[model samples]
Target: MQLPLFPLNLYLLPGGISKLRIFEPRYVRLVKLAMASDDGFGLCMEVNDNICHFGTRVIITDFDQMPDGFLGITIRAMDKFVINHQWQEEDGLRFAQTSVLPNWTPTEIKYIDRDLSQGLQMLFDEYPEHAAYYPQPDFEDMAWVCQRWLEILPLGTEQKQWFMSRNDHRAALSFLHSIIDEELKDK
Candidate 1:
């Protein structure tokens, strides 16, 4: 499927709602297309300021046009996909042929131990302001949590891109644990 890409420095989790303030002309156009069509678009992470190969297909659940020529939109994640090919348009918008991937499996969840679970709970507890924003850490929730944490962590953009590109839920969770452990130790 060919979809319009919206590359950002943030991570979006499944079963999560991301409220975006779209001010750029191209993104505004993308929002309009989504509204007029199926209300779905791609939320992709950037690699060195470029869109990575993998991303999630999201639906615009709610949107309002701001008086300041921007759009406030809420997106719900629906599926994960890998960009098979990309084409750049004259207006700076990208069109990509994407291959949707299967859902994360149960075996991946087994890799998450009690220590990591408690650590995640503690991290959320420590950051009260970010608590509500944090999704429930579970097997079904790992993909989004991994993506979300990758975005919020003080890691390099390259690392964030790598995390987003990862498809194995277990590998992603393990990487997240290492990152969280390093963060906890530094504190």
Candidate 2:
């Protein structure tokens, strides 16, 4: 499938939610086009002035004109895709030919360590604005919890990309365990 691409510094995985402030004309057009069609656009990372190989296809869940006069839109990521080819339109908006990446099978809550979920919940407690994006957050599903951490953590773009490229959540769960365990030990 060909998807409109929005190359930013953000890493969004499936089931992740993020809010974007749209001001650039190209992205604003992308948003309008996305909202008009069920075929959502691709959210990708721009590395060295180029779009990364992997991205998430996201749908606009809500939108409004903010008080600051910019368009505010909340988006939910649906699936991950790998860019096969890309091109730009006259408006400078970019589009890519992509194929869906396989999703990680859902991991049960019992398999995920309790601290990981608690650490994620703590983040939600501290960042209500980010938390507000998800009215009903899933703390039980291991994949959901791990993806949330991957999105918020200050890990390098390449590192996050490597994690996303994996076929399952085992590596991510282990990584989160080490990080969260170290954080807990520091306290």
Steric clashes per prediction = 0, 0
What is each predicted model's overall lDDT from 0 to 1? 0.70, 0.90
Least accurate stretch of 10 residues (summed lDDT) in model 1?
105-114
Q: Which candidate should be chosen as best, given lDDT against the real structure?
A: 2
TM-scores of all predicted structures: 0.74, 0.94
Mind giving the per-residue lDDT tens digits that candidate 2 earns over 1-187? Answer: 8899999898889999888999999999999899889979999998798888889999999999999999999899998988999999999999999999888888877744987888789989999999998899988889889999899889888897888788788899999888877878998
lDDT of 2: 0.90
User: Which pairs of residues collide in candidate 2?
Assistant: none
Mark the regions of model 1 whose C-alpha exceeds 4 Å error after superposition.
Answer: 66-69, 106-112, 125-148, 180-187
What residue runs in model 2 are displaced by over 4 Å at the alpha carbon?
none
What would the per-residue lDDT of candidate 1 be over residues 1-187, giving only the tens digit for each residue? 8788898866664554568999888888888777777737888878666788778888998788788877789787777788999877887777789998765543433454445556556777787766664455452345545555554568775665565555666666777778767877998
